[model samples]
Target: MFSFEDYREILRLVKESGRYATYGEALEREEFIIMRHDVEYSVDRAYALSRVEDSMDFRSNYFFQWTNNSYNILSRKNRDLLTDMHERGHMIGLHFALNGMTDMELIRRRIRQEMDMLSDMLGFAVNTFSIHRPSPAVLAENIKLPGILNAYQDEFFSFDPKAGPDSALRVKYLSDANHIWRYGYPDAETIAAHPRIQILAHPFAWTKKGYENEENYRTLIREKYAEMIDSIDGECKDFSPYREGFMGMLT
Candidate 1:
């Protein structure tokens, strides 16, 4: 039942604790919570989640994948959504997809190309990135690119209990992957126990009404198809001659 209400409750707990901070702000603080969203499915969902966060005066980082064809980041509709999120005080970052790429030099090249393109499209400089479906080798390397903060890097986050004992700063990370909270939902009890925490939620996993993972994808596809049809209808209206022909073809 991870609906919008559930999301609101999570924010309420974070606000009550007064430990929530954006990724950039968290870097400066000794102990803080980093609320992040990876936009893998729909920008519309991201916008909806951003509105929820706005109501609670909470700011988080949204990392978007340029490689994902499900949503066009450069499209006017999505660009507007991103702009709205930015205006609402949420930071935007790159969700870089290695796609099992093993070459270090090639990885760096692709990262720069995508980051620059995305930054230009958003009219903002993206300084942070999170690897999308990173492989074991990529995670082990922990390569840090210039001018960008690596979310997966050891310096920023760690899940090792042994590392926690050795290092002064400890990072507790949790994520909602495949519509399931693998590490369990971050309730008040969980938040209180961890001094430094990172909660990664995917916007697509949440909805105004609770939906299963498959239902979320179906809804998005339906909406996208309807949007395309509407655009075509609008264009046909301008060209009266084509309107009749297009309508006939449908019939």
Candidate 2:
């Protein structure tokens, strides 16, 4: 298994080298791809992502769950690192577990718990949220919940095909976990480049070459960074710093 540090190097090449492409450029060249990752407490993976940020000289959103053992969300080290990343301009969002997907009240309570937990651990309020293992039905139903989904803060849902484009679909992304682009979900580049900000990632996915793995699902993630980074090289612009025009309303 490739360590997270290896992943960092991949990102580094993209940001620092300028050799790495952006979504904007990739689209024009017919090779647009975006590199984003969701870290469920896989410290090694997270570390690699951090390195990638360092290498690229840019920060990408990292969604973390509070229930995993890879790293304790409450650990001071975890808190400090999370806060440090945020302070350094990286985004930190909630990785909501499946249990919290059903009940709005439960979701609300859980959000508070998660936000408070993260705040206590990282010394900041957790606002943004993304659901893990979100099924289309669950996503649509969750959207109907009163104070969950988009209520507390930004809710990250992998594109809901049923909800269609008119709904709150924001970012589009796929998991590279198996060395292949997660073909089941919506296209991430389109979502990222959308009017609203899109958050996407799969920390566990990568190929040895650092480009995206298209040949087969193997254990090489770093190798495909070039292809992945190049894929998004010009398809869209970064939506970081978060535009405030929405006024906290879920449109």
The all-Cα superposition gives candidate 2 an RMSD in Å to the true structure of 16.7
lDDT of each: 0.79, 0.50
The window of 10 residues in a row where model 1 has the poorest summed lDDT is 159-168
Cα-based lDDT at residue 209, candidate 1: 89
- TM-score of the candidate numbered 1? 0.85
Worst 10 residues of 2 by lDDT: 148-157
Q: Write the per-residue lDDT of candidate 2 for residues 102-154, one digit (tens) a residue.
A: 66567657766776677666766566556666656545554433332331121
Global CA lDDT of candidate 2, please?
Answer: 0.50
Candidate 2 C-alpha error for residue 74, in Å: 2.2
Model 1 agreement with the true structure over 52-135: per-residue lDDT tens digits: 888887888999988886778888878888888888788999999887789988987888888888888899888888889877
Q: Tell me the TM-score of each prediction against the true structure.
A: 0.85, 0.54
Off by over 4 Å in 2: 1-36, 142-171, 184-199, 206-251
lDDT of 2 at 13: 39
